[model samples]
Target: MKRFPNQIIRLIIPFVIIIAGLLIAKKFLVPASFGKLGHFRADALGEAMSKPIHYVGQQACADCHDEIVKKKAASYHKGVACEVCHGPGSAHVDSPTENKPPAPRDRGFCPVCHSYNPSRPTGFPQIVTVTHNPGKACISCHNAHDPVPPHAPEQCGACHGDIARTKMASPHVDVPCTVCHETPTEHRMNPRMYVPTIPANREFCGKCHAKDAQSAKEIPRIDMGTHGERYVCWECHYPHLPQVYNGAAK
Candidate 1:
């Protein structure tokens, strides 16, 4: 550059001034301990330590609640810490007799962890709290300390809960579960080993739906010969909801 052009010099001047201003401001504005060891202020460690510790950890709970703690450890809730639901235990630790940690007993409280959400990790137990055993507290059936079935499932809904909920609102609500799936008594003890039988052919459904079938007159009738020939009824219609199993029909 033989000589600095006025237009170029004007742009350079503002940038230089701004850079100098930022450098000068940083020295005064930033904490003295900032970036001492890393990006964090060195004084931040002391600030956090000054705050009071609330949780005494799980071992602290075993002193008084040994039986319940052992039960929870052996159950599905082994990984869950006690304070996660019960809140901070510092108050109770100082006066164990007087300050009993309040327990969550309401139906709404359990849903915070157990309610159905797609974002939650797969295989995690979830329920549609609105339709799942409505009007009953979760603790009524499930012991909070050791949550497992009290006995073998007496109702199909105990395991096939989603299907049960659908059938509740469907036209087949009055239909018995045994009518569709021929479940054996042994299936209750070992469901995997002793499986239930599904309808093999359309004739099974025709027992209820055929026009001339000896069944309730109020039940909808279909011509088994013409309607859904060759394919089984369940291929198109879900027995529980009594609608198209796949893509929407209505």
Candidate 2:
């Protein structure tokens, strides 16, 4: 009593076939346990459990590496698991001599975490691998296990590397770090314990930048009282590379 147009029938035939194909595929392809645990497969948990466990816990690694574990526990990498760098350690734990975990000795490997990514949280240490001691490995200058919290650095750049590198090419390049930062003698050996004091007021920067200052004329001048009177100099101008602001060089 009812019939579709030839064009309508053409579309309907393919649609029906596609639907039938999908139903057939689902019947044979989908796991039987699917939807048993609300969009999850109940068998998936058992399947995963049946697989050989590749990673032994951190405590297992520490059993034979107590000294290294202790050093790492006190360093910047304290939170980083040993397996993260050394690969799955279960085999090594089971057969210590025969199944040694691979050590990532490649210089390229370090940039995975150390690369200068702006999206990283503020104050997280980063470096541009291409320009930062290009010929050398990271472990050359810094020990991987105990990078900062345990090692006593002889220079400020050892800890404040990004700042030091920026300042190296800045107008204040010749200026001693002590000129702007009243660094304690102990700061070099124990940086975190003895934090250095930074410029607190515009007047501190005005020592050299003030229009009426008794300093080199080649240096840029600004009336600290009238220009940016409310803000500290470093608030708008980073002390490391003060000439640049909001991506423009002043």
The best candidate in terms of TM-score: 1
Tens-digit lDDT string for candidate 1 (164-212): 9999998889998898889998677557758999888889989989989
Across 121-235, the per-residue lDDT of candidate 2 in tens digits comes to 7556788988998988777777888776334567778777888999999878988898988999876755566789977777888888899999988877877768878777777
> RMSD to the native, candidate 2?
7.9
lDDT of all predictions: 0.86, 0.83
Candidate 1: stretches off by over 4 Å? 118-122, 151-250
RMSD for each model, in Å, please? 9.1, 7.9
lDDT at residue 187 of model 2 (Cα atoms): 69
lDDT of 1: 0.86
Which portions of model 2 miss their true places by more than 4 Å?
Answer: 1-5, 62-68, 76-153, 156-175, 182-201, 207-250
Candidate 2, residue 27: Cα displacement in angstroms equals 1.9
